[model samples]
Target: FDLVELHRSNRATPPGIVLDPFAERALSPADRGGDRREPPDETSGATASRGGSGARHDRLVALDCSWETAERLVEDFAGVHRSLPFLVAGNPVSYGTPFRLNTVEAFAGALCILGERDSAERLLSKFTWGHTFLELNEEPLARYADCADSTEVLAVQDDYLAEE
Candidate 1:
């Protein structure tokens, strides 16, 4: 919940996971050197319930600027980058549009895919239309959550697009 403000010229690497769709890199479990140990069964502990390790400690960073300025803003960043799968926006300004989520919705979607549902819901609850985003993307969110890696996420995203 710590918010660090940075000037556009500042090139210091921000700490933790960064959600940047335009980033050249994509986040994957393999980037963490691969968790070779088998994941516990679904009926087991928090990791099982959450569908993954749920051990992500990097604070997720998101750009709050306009789409036009977003890419330029994060151009110098060198961190773990992840792009959310396709999901429709629920905000009044961008309702029904795909991949145009406001900060809250984007964070929520990212969190959901990371197996952090409670955190996602907490972020979404801040906005009146937040629940709407979740409602509209429930199936895709669930499917994305089940993906083992970014490659799998891309496959699921492709499937969703094909159906659309």
Candidate 2:
């Protein structure tokens, strides 16, 4: 929760502050496979989802940067990496779009997926369009939060993708 790391380097992509291989690289269940949603490999169970226990730790990290840089800096980060399931973006720039959330929205969506709806709402309260995000993603967010793990989350996501 506290700001633990902030490296001010002369280089453009400094260490610690920016991150995310997961958020940028993650594809929807349907996107990962053709028509059928493939489950993650056996080795990925722990990192797949934070569903069952909810609070793995008090801290939640949200990475903000270009996709180009994110891919490069991904290995620099360390933690339980989990991707948010598909949710509609409510930010003005990418409104109604999927997988285009800004940093705050991404943070909120992660919080929602982690089963902390009230905390997520509080975090989103700072922005005007934030409420709209919750409104747009309410159903999926709730379903995702209730999932037992990534497999269940993927099943729920496949249902949404089927509607599109």
Candidate 3:
């Protein structure tokens, strides 16, 4: 995972799908046409877990700043930006809170929705509380993963929120 310190360089370009709430575009499997490219086989490892179509050469970018500053900072990078579907945060700081993921959690959630389960698991393994996030949001994450577009994602989110 290449961590780009947004404060360090103004020239840094986001590698792949960016997890930005302020993004105008939504990352969806159908948005890229059909999955014409072959996804990496199970034994291929991390490199095979690139989200979205294999055509794009980039990595998933998650801003690590405070939420107050995230909106502004996210505008600085350019790429395919996507907003995460509604789910609860599992980190101690905001346990049970909805839509407030730390960097690792955000990455994992985004990866899972993008059908990169192995990659998501790999990222979550870096943090002790990672598994908790998966457990807490298992249903929402599964629903979000099945969505073909952002509209479907939003619908799922709405249904989940309404249930609360």
Among all candidates shown, the one with the greatest TM-score? 3
- Per-candidate TM-score against the hidden true structure: 0.74, 0.67, 0.77
Model 1 per-residue lDDT tens digits across residues 1-164 = 32224333324433335567675534443333223333211110011112233233244556667889777665444435566778899999999999898877876787777667887887677778889999999999898888878888788888998997
Q: Give the 10-residue window scoring lowest on summed lDDT in candidate 2.
A: 40-49
Candidate 3 lDDT over 17-112, as tens digits, reads 567766554555443322334232111001222634444334565666799988767656544556777878999999998878887788788777
In model 1, what is the error at residue 4, expressed in angstroms?
Answer: 9.7
Question: lDDT ranking from best to worst?
Answer: 3, 1, 2
Top-scoring candidate (lDDT): 3
RMSD of each: 8.5, 8.9, 6.9
What local lDDT score does residue 80 receive in model 2, on the 0 to 100 scale?
Answer: 36
What local lDDT score does residue 4 receive in model 2, on the 0 to 100 scale?
A: 23
Residue 88, model 2, lDDT: 88
Q: What lDDT would each prediction earn against the true structure?
A: 0.62, 0.56, 0.65
lDDT value for model 1: 0.62
TM-score of 1: 0.74
Better of 1 and 2 by TM-score: 1
| Candidate 2 TM-score to native | 0.67
In angstroms, give how far residue 87 of model 1 lies from its true place: 1.3
- Candidate order by TM-score, highest to lowest? 3, 1, 2
